[model samples]
Every structure is written in structure tokens, then in C-alpha cells.
Target: MKLQGKTAIITGAAKGIGAATARLFAFEGARLLLLDKDEANGAAVAASIAERGGKAVFRRCDVGCEADVRAALDTVVDVYGDLDIVVNNAGWQLNKSLLETTAEEFNAVLNTNLTSMFLFTKGAAELFIARKKGGAIVNVCSTFAVVGSPGYAAYHASKGGVASFTRAAAISLMPHNIRVNAVGPGTTDTPGLHDGARDTGDEDQGMKSFLALQPLGRFGKPEEIASVIAFLAGDEAGFVTGALWMADGGYTIV
Candidate 1:
């Protein structure tokens, strides 16, 4: 169990990458507090883990809200005793060009996708420093951070910000023994991706277009991406920080 005895909080844990990551972490022996706005699914995730003999709790949260963020940290302390890892995987996507996106849409995307990471990192770092224990943070970014597309302008900007914020947080938190890193997934087949596809006006066409860009000819599995996040969070990656590990099916290389 790579994460045996660790306690973790994973945002967006109701679905997609966050959910996958939570399941994997629990399998690897981490007690979990799963946060998501989707209360039913989040609770189901926690219940499944508990059925498998893992310790897990579900808490509804809007990750971008400061009050919600603070309450989550408090819940971690009260429920799990202490925290060892933070996975900032909550995000919002807009499948629209700059011209098509509204001012409100852009701001909401930024708050959910970028600002949430900052709140968690700062809170986790402070807690880790206070407790005199090292911790790991894994942020979910996207290949769109480095590459560009005609649509998802706001999403691209948010993920690009995630990559930069991760690097800076890593450096700043290094002295306090908190490792901050990110994972960039490319064209993953998640509920979020499907939603983005629908937003493109045609799910079939949007998906085919995404698959065409994948050099591997298939999308990265949620489990595959989750494995990378588990590695970064565990002690096996003790020397790693300030890194953006791209699990993008060779999308960025070409």
C-alpha cells in the first residue's frame, strides 16, 4: 500500500478523474474525504470504498468557495484526524471560442478551474506546516494548457494557469515539505468530456475530432491517469515536485 496510513481530500470526487483518483487512493490504503457538488454520486463513491473495506466520507462542497474550502479542511481534521494529501481535481469547462463565451462564463470557469487549486494549496500547506508533516498535492490540468484549440478558450486559459500555479506553489511550499505537482490528461473519455462534446453541438463529431488528435488512436483511461496521480502523491515520488506529468496519449509531443 503506497499510501498506507495517509489521509486525503480529493475535490470533484463525484465523477471523472477525481472519482477515479479517490478509488485508487483508497485501494492503496488512504483514508479519504471526497468533495463534490454532486451529493448523491459523491456519497455513492464513498459508500463503495467503505464496502471494499476502505475508510471514506463524502462531503458536498463548491471547491471554489473560500467558506467551502475552509469547511472541507476542518472536516478532514475532524473526520480523518489529519491530512497528508490534497487533490485539486475539480474544474469547469466551456466549449466555446473567445467570441462565443460570455464574461460571466469566463469568470466562472476561472473561479472553478484555477482559483480552487489556490485555496486548497494554501490551506493544505498551512496545515502541513503547522503539523510538521510533509504532504503532497496533485492538481488536474489538461494538454490544452500547452496546446490550443479553436474552442474551450476559457478552459485552455484555466489549465494553463494551473500549470504555472503548480510550479510556483511547488517552489514556495518546498521548504515546508509540501510537494505540489500536476497531471495533464489529453482527450480523456469522462462525463465531463462528453458534456464538452455536447456543448460542441454534436457529440459524435466532437468525439471523433478529439480522437483524431490522439497519436495513440485512443483516449487515456481514467484509471491510467489516476495511476500517475497516485504515484505523485505517494512516497515513491518523494523527489518529485514542480512537475507537470503529461498523460496525454502523445498529443503534446506532435
Candidate 2:
């Protein structure tokens, strides 16, 4: 149990990569605080963890809302006494070319993908500083953060912000023993991906297009990404900070 007795808060943990990470962290002996806007799904994931003999609690949180995020973090710290790890994994995708993207749409993507990271980092850093115990923060980025995609201008920009923010935050927090890092995953098979495909009205084509870009000829699994995140949050990665760890299955190689 690499994370035995640690307390972790994972955002967007109702399903997909966030959910997978929550399960893995629980198994590794972390008391889990899972947050998602979907109450039913979040509660279901928490219930499953408890059934497996792991400790967990679920809360409905819209990470984009500052008040909601603040209250949620306060609740976690109050319940667990200390916060050891925070994973900023809540995000959404909008497939729109730059020309077709509206201001509202662009803001929406930024708020969820980038702004939420800022809010959580701010809130968590305060807690860590107050406790005088350094903690780890893992921001979920995308391969697109480094590579440009035609129809993902907003998403790319937002994730790029995450990558940059991760580096800056890491440097600033190093003196406090806080480590800030990010994981850039390639296209993974998650509920969010499926939903994006459906929104494009070409689920099959969308999936095929994603597969074609991957050197592995297949999309990644949520657990694969979760594994990298778990490593980053563990003591094994103590010396690593201000880094963007890529798990793109060679998608960025080309």
C-alpha cells in the first residue's frame, strides 16, 4: 500500500479517468474524497469503494465554481484532518475549429479545464501551507497541450495553460515542499470521449480517427492514465516536480 493512511481528493471522479484513479488510490490505502457534479454516479463510485472495504466519501462539486470548490476542500480537510494529495481531473472537451468557436463556448472550456485547476491549486496550497506539510498536486493535461489539433483550439489552449501553470506552481511551491506536476494523456477511451463523439454526430468516425493517430492503433484506457497519476502522487516520485509526464502511446512522437 504505497499510499497507506494518506488522504486524497480527486475531482471529476464520478467516471472515466478520475473514477479509475479513485479506485486505484483507495486500493493503495488512501482515504478518498471523490468530487463530481453527478451526484448519482459519484455516490455510486463511493459506494463501490466502501463495499470493497476502502474508505471513501462522495461530494457533488462543480469545480468551476470557486465557492463550491472552496467549500468542498474545506469539507474534505475537516473530515480527514489533513489533505495529502489533490488531483485536478475534472474537464470537458469541445470540438470546434477556431473560426467556429464562440466566446461563450471558449470560456466554458477554459473554465472547466484551466480555471478549475487554478482554483483548486490556490485552495489546496493554502491548506498545505497551513498544515506546514507539503502535499502533491497532479493536474490532468492532454497531449494536445503540446501538439495542436485542428478542431480543438479551446481545449488545446486550456490544457496548455495547465501545463504552464503546473510548472510555475511547482517552482513557487518547492520551498514549501509542495510538488506540482501534470500528466498529459493521449486520447483515452472514457465516457467524456464517447460523449464528445456523440456530440460530433459521428461516434464511429471519431473513434477511428483517434485510433489512426495513435501509433499503438488503439485508444488508451482510463486505468493506464490513472497508473501514471498514482505514481506521480506517491513517494516514488518525490524527486520529480514541475514536470509534464507524457503518456501518449507515441501519439506525440510523430
Candidate 3:
């Protein structure tokens, strides 16, 4: 019960790492607000948690939109009475080279993958600072932030920006007892990865290549990444902040 009695908002909770985090947090006794653009999946995840005797509410939200971000935070306050943690797990990626990527595509990826962090932190902090309560923020980044990869120009830029933003936000919010950190995951077996594989025209080949890159000789599971997020959000991470944790199975080490 690491998060017992705490209220947490998990954006992108419809599936993948976000959904996994929601389940683990719920199991650890958190009151959850699951936010996602995928309304159906988000609701299903929340309902599944409820069916298991955990408390959760699903809200449809576009993390990149300022109004949506505000409304989601407002819902958290109105429904849960207080906010203890936020997992900014929403992200978008397009596997295209700079020459092939359109300006619109670049901006859209940046808005969803990077700017949403600014919005969530700013919006949620208003309530946290006002109520004089401390909180934790966990941003989902990617190993691409540190290691250069062919294609995905915008994705790389956005994730690199997230890592930098995490550090800056942590330093700025420290006085208020807000701990901001990031989790950089390697090639994980998420729906997004499958989608990326399809886009590249070979799911099996992509998986094999990805697995070969990992020192663990396998892909990461969503639950593995979520476990780290759970740890960072809990009381055990009280003394930790401004850190970028690699949950990538040593993918970056090689």
C-alpha cells in the first residue's frame, strides 16, 4: 500500500505503460483518475480497476490542449478532493526522417509529446501550491533522448526536450516539495511499439532487432516500466528528484 489514500492522475491511462501504472497504483491502494484521448479504452481500464475493488475514474482528455489539461486537473480536485501525483505518460511519435517529416507533423508531435508536460505541470501545480500540499510528477521519456536513432527526428527532439524539461521543472518546483522526474524506457512491447513496427513494415523483424539491442536479450514489458513509476511516486522516493531513471534493460549502455 505504498500509495494508500493518495489520489493520482495518470494521463494516457487507456493502454500501455499508463494503463499498467494505473493497475499497479490501484493495487497499491490509490484513488485514481485515468485520463486519455482514447475514451473507450480509458473507461474500460478504469472499470476493470473498479471491478477489482480499486477506486478509479476515467476522463477523456487531450493532454496537449490547455483547456483539456485544466479541466482534467479540475476534475481531479472536484472528484478526488486533492491531487497527490500525476503521471504524464501521454506521447505521440512518427518514424520519419527530417526530410520526410512535414512541419505540421513535427509541431503536432512536439505539442503532444513535449508541450503537454508544460501544461500538466503548470496546471496541476496551481492546485498543489495553493493547497500547500506537495506532489510528485513522473514524465515518460524514451531512450532515444540520449541515444541517436535513424529516423524519428521529431520523436527524438521531443523526448530530449522532455528529459531537459524534467530537470528544469524539478529544480524550480523543489521549494514547494514537488518532485519531478522522468523514466526513459527502451523498446517496450506496447501497442505503440506494435504500431511503429507495422509502420516500418515488419513487426517480427523489428522485435528481433530491438531484442538484440537490449543487454537483457528481450523487450521490456509495460509492467516493468510501471513498477519504476510506482516507486518514484511513492513515499520511498521522498529524497529523490530531478533524476532521469533508465528502465531500459541496459539498452543505452551498449
Per-prediction TM-score, please? 0.98, 0.98, 0.98
Over the stretch 1-254, how does candidate 2's per-residue lDDT look in tens digits? 99998899999999999999999999999999999999999999999999999999999999999999999898997889889899999999898899999999999999999999999998999999999989999999999899987897899999999999999999989998999999999989999999877777899987776677789888899999999999999988999999999998988887
Alpha-carbon deviation at 82 in model 3, angstroms: 0.6
The digit string of per-residue lDDT tens for model 1 on 176-206 reads: 9999999998888899988988877899998
Report how far residue 5 has shifted in candidate 1, in Å: 0.4
- In model 2, the worst 10-residue window by lDDT is 205-214
Candidate 3, residues 1-254: lDDT per residue as tens digits? Answer: 89999999999999999999999999999999999999999999999999999999999999999999999988998998999999999997798998999999999999999999999998877778998889999999999999987799999999999999999999999999999999998989899888887777798887676666778888899999999999999889999998999999888887
**What lDDT does the true structure give each of the candidates?**
0.93, 0.93, 0.93
lDDT of 3: 0.93
Model 1: weakest 10-residue lDDT segment is 192-201
